[model samples]
Target chain A: MKLEDQRTTVYKVDPDHPETESLPTLRTEELLLNMGPQHPSTHGVLKVILELEGERLVKSTPVMGFLHRGVEKLAEGGTYHQFIPHTDRLDYVCAMYNNFAYCRAIEKLMDITVPDRAEYLRTIVAEVQRIIGHLFWLGTQALDIGAMTVFFYTFRDREILLDWFDELCGARLTTSWYRIGGVEKDFTPSLFEKLKKFLEYFPPKIDEYVIFLEKNRIWLARTRGVAVISAEDALSFGLSGPTLRGSGVDYDLRKYEPYSAYPRCEFSVPVGKNGDTYDRYWIRVEEIRESLKIVTQCLEQIEPGPILADVPSVTLPPKDRVFTNLESMIQQFKLFSQGFEAPAGEIYCGTEAHKGELGFYIVSTGGGNPYRLKIRAPSFIHMGAFDFMSRGYMIADAITLFGSYDIVMGECDR
Target chain B: MHAIAEKIQEKFPAGFLNAQEWRGDLAITVKREALHDVCTYLRRDPDMDCDYFVHVSSVDWPDDEERFEVVYEVYSIRKRHRIRIKTRVPEHDCIVDSMTDLWYGADFMEREVFDMMGIRFRNHPDLRRILMPDDYTEGYPLRKDFPVQGKGWRDSFDFLQDPN
Candidate 1:
């Protein structure tokens, strides 16, 4: 019999008296399916092994390390100043936050205080980077769930942010704009004007995306009540960022730790009632609105001042000073050749990256380079819950479950 | 932070090694054998309540008598304070009790430690090489003795030559 005929005949003769019929019983075995170390929906090179009985997943395991570059080992060999570029590649989508987190970790270890104006500049750029990171996630996630229009709309705004990044720094994507003391250079007057305009224009676009996705019949069936994780299980699994907040856990690192200019701002962290895919989606959208409010506040508060702190050995001197003064020239050469010495200690600094709590544990042995640097990447820990979350769900709905975590594999495998 | 450290010392006197504070974070080193009991007490005790498991990683200190120091970072969500629990494992006995029963999140973090730092975990349900490939027979990449550029794998790769 043909494959279609076999399936049809088994169902047709089995309703009233299955034992009385002369047909053999249909046997189904667990099927193993490999879903991409290279698929488009995975966001990066993440491979998942699925064992399914018919269409329902029996067991699932996420196999990572395809994009592993041994970032921790590289940190052991390089100077503290040289490691800033390495952080840019960890969470490449929100590159500015990676730079900020790593630099802040070093600053905390050495007890270096950032200047007042530099703190506000770091705050403004970091929030703008948060929107860019969430925008990329929203576009790709909506496309994965079969909504094509949001991808176009989100990317259209993301281009404007990227262009602004290029104008501020030299590059767009992997911008090493943040330095150890502060930002590389202050935002120009025109760049500040552009950021103010973007803050004004973005709130209505968020409403438009929400309007398009809120009542769509396909979006409702796909996301509502799908891949539900309770508040307690979400906490025990070590989930952070918006994924944990979606479960009604009010543990925003910004609100809890109050780093940088976050303590001065008067924005609210949105919490979800139901821990589902729709809640996570709603959390990111609401967060963008809150981030815009912070940017508007920063624009009014920012004042003109020196961008970099006046730390002698750590912060790089100005270009004019390096050209004219001999002492400044020697200081620049010594910093690059041998990084500044740090007191022997270990500290783990966790920042509210766009994805989650991006933690960096640096162990220095009073040397120029770190003795050991372990990155507590949020995506790596988030992937551990894949087997627990995806069990007993249809294999087709696995995409929705994976999409809800908002994981980027660069940080996962690093 | 000192109160919690004193509480653990009062409960298990022999298990506590010493407590050190750096940059306002408390780090308490404990005996390796008593780690499971200490962790369980920290999780269940109402005053301690270190419910959130931040991460579990190991640092290679080849010069020390106990060469590998396994570090566990935990935070109390309700109390809003953090602490570090450090336990040393000798080079020969690199196995530590797994916390998979306590927190579901430690599953892969322990496996990654086993894969990279060559540490093993007892009572772990699924212990295998996670980040490295299945057939990989090379030494642990994160160990102090392992060369950063790698040994023969890069130079022996045949496809690196020009095809034309």
Candidate 2:
């Protein structure tokens, strides 16, 4: 029998038949269960309405917006510069990339060219952010699948990266280090040495984590061939980043539309044959290595230069310059007060964020503020296919399916 | 991209309203009624195959005669080309054809647009509030006329307590 036919076997029951009515009257009704909104295994505030027939999932519907902060509506009211901090709140685990993605959107909107050094710096930090994000996902995902040891190991290593972020920016989680024109500041010599050390030290840690999970029978049994999605299905569902790549899709915005210093760097996109939970897990682990490689190349290519772009009108003047020169003060005041005017147009800028294509569709009506901003969050899109992916799978495998998606509620509900 | 636009124009001259380009992205405005057909052509047509549905959002233009502009962004993974389709839907009649039949991913996107912008879908399988709660009776938040802080929903703790 074909797999499709086997999965879709419908048992016809004659309600009026004597034998059917007399056979103990065993009527099996679908059990409606709410999986989330508060449950730890459901990640953050993700509520799923699941209709189950025994262990098999009959149907699933993901309920989101428990963490909705209306960031898009907030963006319309605030200036482009003021909205940078708010971007950090979305996907707070990888705040740097959110900042980078948003800044890149507005940068494209205003048509401001970022300096080479800034691009290199942004690329390096963004990759570092990706590693941090993957590390968080690895820890939480392992914890969800009854592997507490892996969580501890991943979190221990994740701390070093978080510390590096703290050193780079004043805040740790919501690191609004990226600016519209460029980055806030250049990395210090000590910070650069620390980053170089981190870049050297991280790949082996990824391998160590992978080694622990790769051949483990429990891990294999739980993940292998579970929540499988084909390449076509993944693309049709708008899955991107490692999630789509895990499903044998070779569509990475970083590779397709090379932005920032991505064009200069040489890195391979890892794809999986089987689009399963294990494949997605392995893809993220491989991507950690690939991100480290990109960071290494960025470190080698990065040189000392102006971190901020030369667009004085768009970027805020230096505090020292503002204090000393009258022109600089005026520029600073004007930049903060009226904000730089963007051309009356609409543009969609998608950067390969940690989870997926963190796309920002900005529509500017020739003003300092965007008329409308829509965040094409990958987590939100991935949640759309949750029901399709979780169907026909065991209730236990539902956790694995959810973990594989790597959804951050903040981004999904934004 | 203009070639693709020209092809679309040739295929459905009545549906194709206008075409423009910005930042190298091809955008074509179409009739609201022909959205389903245009989307089918974009997805199934080998010459103009746009299989990937990126996003679907609505922009509220209260002053405009149409009132709401529904935007759809789709990408052709095979061709490596992207195109944006815009259709105007009036406030009184907020219904537009859903592309869920073409791309299942448009399910939640259409729901979100409906939830926030108050635009309804014609053939959407399950069009409900995906983000906002089911009991949410407030006006669509994404409307331009909607207040930022909202109309007294925040101050009231009535939503916190179960009505039942």
Candidate 3:
């Protein structure tokens, strides 16, 4: 039996049941409760102002911006390269993907082309990050909704991915591994070996998760058709990533825009028939399987080449250049001091990460810094769809619906 | 080749649709003020169903007289082409027509523009603070004109002087 449908003695009231009288408007009973800004299952510091009708949420207005560090504004204060490190913190869970998105936008404005090898490397890291991100979502969502054991099993494998990330960059989560020109380095040999091993072993482990939840009758009854959002409604709300695909839109940035060498990589966008909590859950789980495919392809196809592009002014010269030649020393000084200059035009670049379409709209005035950079985070838009879906469902399903959306609050507030 | 820009070019012959480019899937552009008519045509015109409003975001351009440029990323899943419409509003008159009637998705996005940029949306329903606190009325945060680090942080626990 589902934990939600089972009567828990928290409030001694089942407000969702229509057979019970509509909640009374007694001044003593009605308490205006704050759900988050710190509470678990809110995903991040998402504060929801939920007015209670005696245990049932009558009106819920999501209050954001507690975590807003004026990122977009702070970006304007610094040079173009200075903003790259800031992007790492926007969506801390998927830092590489954020780095990729911000750099791609600047590249678009500057009219620079990334090397094929760098694109492939980005794809490998992006897909792996997607797997890691979705696993975090599935684990946390399940645990938040009462399936506690999923977290234990899910984090065990999550550590393996984080270990690979730590090896790639010094830090596990905030991997500032991308500059404007390309990635920090090519996929190292030791890292590649472990990833190849992971690609081989992770799929069956995903199936283990499926066997635990997908077939369980209680999990199905709890999720299936709980909060149904049609393709039309989802599109209207600007939903993307797994949330849009879960509703069977089949519009993924990887498939459509084909950025970061996604066209060369072989991975199908798994879509759903019905747009519900169950479909959203299944789509993410299936995406983990598909991301593994992309990762394997990227590993096999990676070429041994310089990770940074031929552009020395925009890209960092090797540390060897710092010690070796006079001209190389001058170039390194210019790059660090003046930073890279971009053309005077605006360009927007988006990619399919763990989230739907993460886009960066960058406007340049031919200077070393961006004139303006607007981040179109998918979670920020996806969070708007909450009221539409949560209207008829029980209050408990709010946690499930919010989790199924897979929002990272840092990005949303940023 | 998207029809809305083409139609826009034909309709306002002189200087309505300035420049249009198809970046992958979206028909992106730079337009000054005819946003109201362009969006109306996108929805009413049978050829373009851009009926589904995907997202709307604002970017601050501090140097230019036109300080804030709001970008509207729209989509028509029925026809399958996305269009990004843009407009630049001076800091004095940040007010713009709300597209909530055309697509309900614009509701929150408009509120966001109101919240962050302090750009007033004329006809939005619940246009109170969405991101910032209801008590906050000092200045717009997203605008490049806004200061990053103010002399507001307290060294000690100044209980009476919390700015946030």
Candidate 4:
């Protein structure tokens, strides 16, 4: 039987009613689907309520704060020096950037200038962290889009960098190597050699990872033209880093407001024409290459000098000095116990992290502990535009949207 | 004074209270009633094109007459300049105009301020708790009076109780 005839026979027309319709209409309603407070693709504990009309997403409400430990509130309770470790937990995946950003903010507040060598060191480590962050994002985002081979390839290279971080600092993931004035220690000979070798080995690996997804039909279909936002909307929504640059708005804090060793190094910021998932992915990959170039330049230009800024009131004494000299021991003790007094003012300093602009706004009332500390976490701000971008996209693209923003729940909820 | 601050002061003399520049950051304090107008001017004016919304933060000053200070930091992508627009509201009337219409990104940021500081936004479309749970009945967590250890609600939860 024909489909129309079957439908007509299924719903028998009422002969008694003169105005009976020819076919019965199917009742349709929007489906409310919850995509995860615990789902693996969310990167962290993040819940998004997706309103679906069939397969298309009508609206999405991101229910954040599953990982809220009140890092800002905790900052109010600790001294300025004590808060360094606390920042390590903000963006757990890329803790070095958080430390760099927080320490940069404090340095700005105190008007401390880092030495040239320290600046180069900070930039090198920060770029390495950027590479790791992009690798983590690439691996997980490809896995979310159903390409599994790229994940293994990307993570394989990521392991080397993590091991480098382990040798650089004692810890691998939560390396608090950055301090208020400068880096904790200088690069050793072995560390320098390993970094130089990795710099040569990394470019081909990037090409290998790209080969997996560059022409894969499924990857192209899944990422291309997905979650497209205009340049105007992106700026108005305060999107930054690759997410903002993907929309063709060249608003990089490193280039616009140069800081650290970025001003000294020569590198290009990659921008995309079409603001979509594919463009964002391309921007991240290009950024990794640019970061490698930056690291190489820093290595070539670096000169032997003091790593830490010798500011007695603000910076800590060296470990050797602290153990041998009583005055140095007293200085370290006083710094850790009482904390250096900060000026009674407020300042906001922004750093260009791998994900986006990580800014710290500190309010000091001439005390050791900050009166109020506000973190302008990019992941949290990007979530604001979730419903607008996710609308009209497929329900499955929800995971793609999350991956594109590189939304870490720890920073989002902080 | 910053050129933008000077322009804001010239445009809204009655609304403008003071301007402070410290550490290359320009902060302007405006009357609470004129907060929206000042931000609108900042957004629409060609010379003061502060289109990028950075963040919305609130500070509690328990001792002051106006107990809550609302801060809205904005940057102009084209101009590459930043401005911090601040306004004060008393504890009894802890409300400010919403900037969601001007900058769509302010939706979540203002909601966060409302959630943490208990300062309401007048025309915010969705002014519910963002980082905190919706059903949370305790006071705002960012308030100074709110204990750092929290309200001990976690200890009082039914999950912690032993099933007899």
- TM agreement with the true structure for every prediction: 0.95, 0.95, 0.89, 0.95
- Per-residue lDDT tens digits for candidate 2, residues A130-204, read 888899999999888887788999999889988988998878899999998889878889899998887777777
Q: List the residue pairs that clash in candidate 4.
A: none
Q: Model 3 chain B, poorest ten-residue lDDT window? A: B22-31
For model 4, the docking class works out as medium
All candidates: TM-score of chain A: 0.93, 0.94, 0.90, 0.94
Model 4 chain A poorest 10 in a row by lDDT: A1-10
Q: Which stretches of candidate 2 lie over 4 Å from their true place?
A: A1-24, B156-164
What is each predicted model's overall lDDT from 0 to 1?
Answer: 0.87, 0.87, 0.77, 0.92
- Candidate 1 versus the native: TM-score? 0.95
Sorted by lDDT (best first), the order is 4, 2, 1, 3
Candidate 2 total steric clashes: 0
> Candidate 1: which pairs clash?
none
Q: Cα RMSD (Å) per model?
A: 4.8, 4.5, 6.0, 5.9
| Model 2 whole-model lDDT (C-alpha atoms) | 0.87
Cα deviation at B42, candidate 2, in Å, is 0.5
